[model samples]
Target chain A: MAILITPETKIIVQGITGDFGGRHAKLSLDYGTQVVAGVTPGKGGQFFEYGAHKVPIYNSVADAAKATGATVSVIFVPPPFAADAILECVDAGLDLAVAITEGIPIKDMIRVKRAMTGAKTRLVGPNCPGIVTPGTGKDSFGGCRIGIAPGYIHKKGHVGVVSRSGTLTYEAVFQLTSKNIGQTTCVGIGGDPVNGTNHLDVIKLFNADPETHGIILIGEIGGNAEVEAARWIKANCKKPVAGFIAGATAPAGRRMGHAGAIVGGAEDTAAAKIAVFKECGIEVAATPSDMADALLRAAKAKGVTLT
Target chain B: MNIHEYQAKALFEKFGVAVPKGTTATNPEAFVTALAALPEGPTMVKSQIHAGGRGKGTFTNGFKGGVKFCKTKADALAMAGNMLGQTLVTAQTGPVGRKVQTIYFTVASDIKKEYYLAILLDRATSRPVIVASTEGGMDIETVAHDTPEKLFKVLIDPAYGIADFQIRDLITKLGLAGAEAKNAAKLIRNLYTMFWETDAAMVEVNPLITTPTGEVLALDAKVSFDSNALYRHPEIVALRDLNEEDPKEIEASKYSLSYIALDGNIACLVNGAGLAMSTMDIIQHFGGTPANFLDVGGGASKDQVIAAFKIILGDPNVKGILVNIFGGIMDCNVIATGIVEAVKEVGLKLPLVVRLEGNNVVAGKATLAASGLALVAGDTMADAAQKIVKLVA
Candidate 1:
């Protein structure tokens, strides 16, 4: 079983009438994701057909979650209403919510995050590509072409991949696939300052997963999240892990789309993270390809071979 | 995203927090008039820039002589004329810097109470945290490090906002008592209100001082606005000071690309910030250097991509170029087309390596397929980085 989402999970599409939301809903439906409901506030009682199944639309997240019993919510609402939409989902008791929208006000996110602290609900991103479980189906807020990277790259193996960069995750998977390495799950933990599920959290999940033999962690510059995850991996993770920290050449003080990817001072550099991971005895890849190779090496070191 | 001190203080004042009366000055005459309007006493003239560390530099002391006690309009005018349009190079921003566009002239308060306070966006916690200390005026970073317990922090609940009890506790911890404590609490609440209303990423008041009359005054203000929220706040649009920012950064802003100037030799143009920073770090680790950190963003058009390339090449210190693109919604083929056009336009003789992956990788490779340009296309990020490092070396 995967960590958060699966094929049986009923999903609700927030801002379903909007261009971005509507487009991703169609793609998710095409990918065979169990999209049970859509919500666009004023456009309630409308219907969108996916295959033989017809999904009903609702006015609000609470209404949709009540009627459809949607466990997961993918939000495509614009930046302004992002926090409100997520809060509504959390209030509705939806197990997981992923906000595909970018440019959310930091204040609004802080409020959403504070509210989410004790709640059972889990939030993914205000700015991210969302998550995909390969052939079993995918639920992404951002546009990632289906079958772009062969589905065979993700076999139900014992290797799990967690990344801050969505594209890099795909790259790592592509490399692994070429090497005939498949994954139990590949999680794209969006690179937002106030994102839901960090590397440490994902590492904990991978550690607990019996199917996962090794894990590949992809990180970026800015926060000490990667360093913290490395410390956690050293202490808790029983499996061999290979890692790569992005943002090696990024200058300090520049934010690169991802709110979490900012280099305020010298200590937050990518090299510093690499040094930390190395000290923890986790093999560190200087580049993306090296990351995949390092993961393979770690698997070999642990005597877990892939045919 | 960073607004001037005057703009930050204006927002603070609107929320009922007392700030030193100040006006933004575009010219020497306006600067003089604004300074002359302040009450007769030793006035503090602060250079208004988005960056910190202004206090330790040339503009910190106001004029060439000691603290200029402006008794007459002429004295203020002389001070304004000298400071106006003059670049204040500080230890923080380095040489060749921000022009003194606004001079904050205010009455020096009688320091009965001084406290350092800031509401900053904490990345780790992904929340706005209120950091306050009783030992004020000096650097808050110093306070945070030395007497860590002395610095009381309160994580604000976004749904309910800064509670009344939290405000009272913060004031008490800041060594405030009685009516003065209440006033201080009110100021804290007002500051939090201002922080929300202005869509500020950071709002800091160093030395939130109390006068001999027990009046709370924000002696110094520092604010960083959310750039994405600038569309909503049109007033902040006027506060954009191009002179204070790097020319390349300013140019990249025009194309909506995120860029930060760094002191390195290799200019990097990556699709995303994480990759860009990683490339920079790798360059430094391999004994090479990076001149700038540029992220073309996700939805970059060919023109925008070309513009980003041009900006990177504009850096005089740039010895080589590294273009790393992991195409998501943005196609590598689209980026390659822009790179081809950019190389021709800029006539870049500097060694370059292009790492393009995802979304039509075959087509992306085909576009630049066999172009006799000195461009080396890498199949992966490692190859591209290693190639660039070797070429630069």
Candidate 2:
């Protein structure tokens, strides 16, 4: 019932010859993800085994797509080449592209975004931990463990978890898991300024998922992304949602964590985002623990019973 | 990752963005030599420190006061010598900080037209946004705050490049006419190219000035390079000013950890800065103290984790250690390995409390099972903070 990725989705690994790429590809295969092919220029005709299933490798994304019909492309190219890698995937007509590479130059992403306008292909991240659909066994990137639902602290209910910080997504999930609650899906939208997909984009997907009852959003200080997402959640999302904005106490004009997490001007701050979320009638978590509690109360108020 | 103005201007020049002729002077003698190299008469002297507010600094202000038009090379040398190595306490760096390392000597231009221009990655839109304002030379923070409407911000289309229409609109907003407008538009396009080529995190030209002779030149420049993208930009990597950075932060970067010094009493060792700062805030709220802010970063190894612990413990103000780790790509077991080993090596008598979560939590817990070290493990941040506060109190 999760959006974007599923067990049935065929995956292609771009830059699979690289160290990080090869490692993630092996792990993804180990996790039972249907990794169909690998793409690395000058390394075509190679093969990597995922159990009994032999995975073929191609030189470019276009060749890999033609050979294996891989719908989803997970890019592990270096920062400098990440933009070109994503562009290659888009050209190959991938249904979704998940970029694991961090620190991509903003201008390169700007060019990538320009090329993606009105295109059918959807990009997930240029600096993200990628997406994971728990229990049903689906993950875009390698690190997320299968069947290990950190969001299981919140009892099996309809709450969808969305976050910009990759680690914080796991934090929210861990909190929910501790409470014995499970999420329909947890998304790590990424904190890069020029990341693929966003909080609002994921909210739309979650809103349409019948299995998803409510939502929990974890955001950091920086940008108006949270504000934009809160507006969308208020207008469109019907389910109850809880929000937690990190970096509320961060010093003004300091980049606390992510490059994008800096307090830019007035509009980009945790306090401001929390205010917007509160004004929209969405319950706001004062801290990480508080966020998990808020989600619990939201589900309880909606008459959802714990298992 | 921030380059000096002279270096940034060189990058701007390469991309065909007009820039005033300037050179960096390391010493007072070099300052005089740089001033001699530039075309004579009333050149502006600016102290080059990473921290802003040099114009209002005591040393700079004192040097400027001593100068009566600096009509000769001797006068310039005397002024430069007096200013060099002197501490400049300003509004930016509160009393007694940041010595003037270098001074920038430049040919002053009669600014016929002033426009503010900056290229930054817009996190919300996930694109590079070129922010321009006709109201230039003032602080951008003030402009963004008071009169945001006066600014003309456009998301640069990476594919087609900065569109002709958008550039024209920006020029019009800048109140340029005819040839000046066309030239300004071209400058904007070139600046975009420079911004891309340099892998700049932020490229700002405060007072993108049009000289009296109908030439637009970047009067002041500030460029911050993407530290992560430094792998590809070898030239930028070489330009890193080690003196301008905190030694601890520099040392931590070698191990791929991000650490920032803060004025607090309780030194924190956390996995993420968001969590670290939050931990500090929680400690403060609970009437405990936080001395420094340290984020060991993701995927920390045993040695790096040990190094982080040692670095935090090294701080004199640190009475106790609060290790808050919400492991993800990093395994809790690995962190436990580091913590146990570091505690043995450092042999601290200070109270310690650990809050660990995520991958291999059970394994990590198992490793810490019989370690009789004054260590307490909590499942949550609240519990960990409360426990640490109790121990310290």
Candidate 3:
């Protein structure tokens, strides 16, 4: 049982006819995610083909959900319409909407986020690597993946990982897989300034999961999110948590690819966040390799073995 | 994503928020024309730069103010002339200040009470928030540090918007009255509308003023639109003043590389933004200053990798280079091939440290080794940092 998404979850692709959407759809299918349907406006009654697998395309999320029982929505819509697509998915009552689309405007996301209040649907990212529950072989029944991070790097294990950076998630997971310490779930919450899920949100879910023996959090500069999440960990988190913060050497006020990657204040700096993580009595990881060692140590402390 | 004060004012006007009538002047002649359009008496000459604190900042040529209260048209023209070609070093702008290419000329307002107001995303609430204080003429940061109680914030409900009643706290705290309070509430609502419609990340009206004539005005404007949402507003994109930006950054943007120049000796080139940042951090953690932050992105092409190297090497301050690539969406060999190509094309001669992982690592390392470019190989990110720092030291 994974923390956010599982192998059993069926996904519908939003903007599936576009290049990014279409290509990632193929990748997700190859990774064995249950990508059952696609949404492209006025492209209804058509099919998006990735070899013999022809995923049905719908004009709206409503039609696809009605036909395929796709509980999860994997959005690759352009930034302008991405927020509306997420809102449409939420209104359509999808259990989870993973937005791989980066650069959705903050104000637009603000509206989508507001609409999510008390709503049943959970959102992962508007700019993110998405979530993956990697278990066994590359088959629909063996694993779960929702973002653009390379799928083959992940392996099923005990550590639950959440990160704000997409490629770093793959790096951390690859290191874990190399070391024979797999994961319960790997979630890249995204690098946008305003995103749906955060470190604390994923941590809360991981904390409640019995299968996740330890947790690895990858935070970055800009925003006091890591600090806030560390405070939460210090107070109530029951699981062992290892943390890695990016942007430690990042200059202030530089929007580093991700919108939210700037250092807004002193406390949002990597040094500051690492200090907070230390104060929380958590294992601190500086690099991707450091993350693997820290995570395995945490799991060992939690009475688990990698081999 | 940041716009000039005049550009911000243009946005304010579009959103029904009142502001001082101002026109942008790019030349001394335009400055004279804009000054003549103003009512009378003193006019405000503001240097149009992205960073804040222009009123207190000094010019690089030893002039006192980036902002000037010009009593005559000749004075306004002279001030504009003094600013347009020179750099203004504000507290926000480092020692090497930004060159002023435009000046905003506005009619000075009659101020009764100076207040502070800004609308930005409150990450904690995950909602747009309006922060206000009556102590406005000074820095909001100073306000936050000194009198925390004076600062008040209201999270706008996206569904319902900022209700008139929701602004009651600001009104009460600032001692606003029937008309001023009512008008201020309406102003807040309009600002929220602007924030929503423009896909703005932040809109700050420092020294939001109340005139002796019983009117509220945005005395100064600072607005930043979300770069991700720039597609939605091409007009805003058109307002981009590239002259104010770093040439290296501009070039990097053209190649879709996330590059920022820093004052250091070691240039870093990495794949993912997070990894790039962490690589920079480890360099600093190991007592080495990074020259720049360059992210070649996840699926970078060979050309982009070459361009990234060119940009990093463009800065003569860079004495060494560190290439850390963690291949997931990116293949390690692609980076290695690009590095080899860039070295041959540019006659590269810097102490380089290469750390490669993920997809096709062996081939990437093999490619780098075959190039015979005097590159030191590191097994881990930390090891790479230590090696690069040692070489530079």
For DockQ, the strongest prediction is 3
TM, every model: 0.88, 0.89, 0.93
- What lDDT score is found at residue B20 in candidate 3? 87
Per-model TM-score of chain B: 0.91, 0.90, 0.97
Between prediction 1 and prediction 3, the one with superior lDDT is 3
- Give candidate 3 misplaced runs (Cα > 4 Å): A45-54, A138-141, A256-267, A299-307, B71-81
List the DockQ of the predictions in order.
Answer: 0.43, 0.40, 0.50
What is the lDDT, from 0 to 100, of the residue B301 in candidate 2? 89
Model 1 residue B86 lDDT score:
65
lDDT (10s digit) by residue, model 3, range B1-393: 888889888888888899988878787667767777777677788988888778889888998888999886667777788788788899878999988888888888889899988887777677877788889878676777688788887878888888777878778888898777777777787888998888887788888988877788999888888787788788889989898789999999999998988999999999878888888888988999999889898779999999999999999999999999988667899999999999899898889999998778889999999997889999888899999999999
Report iRMS values in order.
4.5, 4.0, 3.7
Model 2 spans > 4 angstroms off:
A15-32, A36-47, A50-69, A136-157, A256-265, A300-307, B59-75, B94-96, B178-183, B272-277, B284-293
Clashes of 2: 19
lDDT: worst 10-residue window of model 3 chain B: B27-36
